[model samples]
Target: MNEVRHFWLGISCLIFKVSKTFRYVDTDNELEKQVGGYEHIVVRCPIKIVDENIVETVQKLPRGTIPGDFLDAIVVGMDMLIKKFGSSNKGKTHLCLITDAQYPIKEPYEGTKEDQVDIISQQMKAHGMKLDCIITIGKLSKAINQKILAENDHLLSQFSRKGVAKMRHVGTPTSLLGALRTRTISSVAIFKDEKVVQGSSEERLL
Candidate 1:
């Protein structure tokens, strides 16, 4: 019998959805079928943040900030996945990062954006993981900003320079599903940057 491939999937969404749309659920189900035979761990982005200080705890997180600290969230999710799934001997675990931000990351604390990207890229290379970023354009077609596209392109270029493949531009669930079914992808750790990073950028096709 042929050995099944393995994958670690992590998905992140900026806008809190009060309800999952038809396409959203359909895309998730389709992705499950596509990876049915593989040993895979699926995780959603923005792992819960809990602040504990002796006598108090906080779970609520504020939103609507420039270049939100989303990379940190992604890393948290990836770490959980890694801990659950044993190391892969294949030299590379697959990661799929789904995001809707056009500019979602920046350089780590005391580091430049380029430095942060390089560090994350190197770390993934060390861990034998490959990443594929799926970006979802804004739902508001009328108010879509040009800066968003520019930022999105820059992000894709940065990842490509670091050796990721099939960085795709998707606007809807159908497009996302089409890309996932046709391409192979993975993800890397999100590092903390010195300042809020900005850029412009996802999907559920698969």
Candidate 2:
């Protein structure tokens, strides 16, 4: 009876129950910026479930109305999450956009997908969480610059530790059934591929 539908690719899906007990230390302050530090953070991930066959309800709307409505729903979700979480640190936000990969975004100009990715990557760089990297992990691949992946690799290195993860590994889903089953709760893995681990924040530094 799970309602969630994961993506079609190999992506898994789960959510973390972020807490202050397991929160990273913040060396960065308004007066000084720390090179390596962790603190309370924020994220704004966009998601779209997989589906084929246009709906009759969608057909009733104007050409642009369908997408516009879905987008509004995303914003509403953001507002709700913000209220649940504490305040956002300045405007630094962690953004993850889960899309159908094949779905094309109509950019204002003729710039390629690579161009858009680069722009967002740079913006994420300024934010420093490296959470802005777009995870196009499913069948819906973006026609983007491979160089963007390299950039993401390097940026992610900043978050590396010598050993295991301090938090859980909640992945994006690959199918509708998997999505519904995946918990909107905390999960974890010691080594990235050793075993698909799951647990709570109390099992810290697993």
Candidate 3:
């Protein structure tokens, strides 16, 4: 788990360096305590990728807190984007999820896991919010429940079919870095005619 957390921080920083903008929300369920209490999901206001302070915050984020319900987190993140940008943002909005595919939806959600996944998929398509996921596999990968990981992959497949998501499974930190860089560049290139460029000139939450 420590290795996964370290690699996650590394990917976050790499994304920040290779993308025009970046924002992050840790999916640890402990965040609910700071938010008053759980309301199906708990998320902080998206941290704007403005300076080194954001990197520091990512590095300092606590690890091994109860993992938030994966599907609920997606729903809440989409809601946050809608509240901030409304329906007009279209393809400009993106939500990137990085996980080890080991956690399950431990908390109660509104519907069955299958139902929640379907709804989330439909919502992302309707709102034009691109969803990308980085599924990390490492020394601890064998401990992950195949059932849970399959469900997560199914959700990603739905988004992929809609042409709004990409999923990458990587085993090492170096490979994860390369995947993040490539995905960031490809995503940015969709909007710009020229070659992909990197700098914090726009706003994006991942």
Candidate 4:
């Protein structure tokens, strides 16, 4: 049974493992706490934001900011913010992005919910914490014919090394956003309700 009432005690955000490796290894995770219902996802974007005035003050430099150099500043800033949280009991921790902003040309692991659970669950156990979830905004496109694409045909077969990720075509205005609330790509967490269907951003609102 789902415990709806257990989720009412507000939320505290934890930021750890700012080592830019996406793996949380440090002993300290108390980063920041907010008095909300975990409505927003804390995304430590890989891109660093700089003040325009700071850049304008650098008169001696021949060139402006180097390409992708801002990412370092963001990483440092996020670490500092994480340090501020200071080991308090944050409700649920979700890893946004701990690496470069741009998607890797090749992904190290399948970015599925189940895959994420397995990979990060170990880290959570290491920290004596249970990570509720980590959400990253990215899209994937697929076209497959199960009958045509079969075994023993290397030239004609193309498959995700992680196997064909089960997908359900969710239609309507808030379909994509609503599906996220379920957290499981293969589960039915909501039902239709007139003009207002469930939203993928429901967690954000919760």
Per-residue C-alpha lDDT of model 2 across residues 1-206, encoded as one tens digit per residue: 01111111111111111111222431111111332222221111112221221122122212211111111112222333333333432232222222222222234245754454454445334433222112324332354445643553333333333111011222343331222222232332110000112333322111
Question: lDDT of each model, Cα atoms only?
Answer: 0.37, 0.24, 0.47, 0.22
> Model 4: clashing residue pairs?
30-86, 30-87, 31-82, 31-85, 177-199, 177-200, 178-199, 178-200
The parts of candidate 2 lying over 4 Å away from their true place are 1-92, 132-206
* All candidates in order of TM-score, best leading: 3, 1, 2, 4
- In the order shown, the candidates' Cα RMSDs to the true structure are 16.2, 15.6, 8.4, 17.1
The best candidate in terms of lDDT: 3
Best TM-score among the predictions, by candidate number = 3
Scored by lDDT, model 1 comes in at 0.37
Q: Which scores better on lDDT, 3 or 4?
A: 3
The total number of steric clashes, by the backbone 3 Å criterion, in model 4 comes to: 8
Could you tell me how far off, in angstroms, the CA of residue 137 lies in candidate 4 after the best superposition? Answer: 12
Off by over 4 Å in 1: 1-68, 89-92, 103-107, 138-145, 182-206
lDDT of 2 at 205: 16
Name the regions of candidate 4 deviating beyond 4 angstroms.
Answer: 1-84, 95-120, 128-173, 180-206
lDDT for position 71 in model 1? 43
lDDT winner, 2 or 3: 3
lDDT of 2: 0.24
Query: TM-score of predicted model 1?
Result: 0.49
Q: Rank the candidates by lDDT, best first.
A: 3, 1, 2, 4
Candidate 1 residue-wise lDDT, 1-206, digit = tens: 00101112232221111111223331222223453311112222232211122001111212222333334433433444355333641233444555555443444557765665666667666666556666665354444455854764675557678885346667664564455442222221221110001121111212
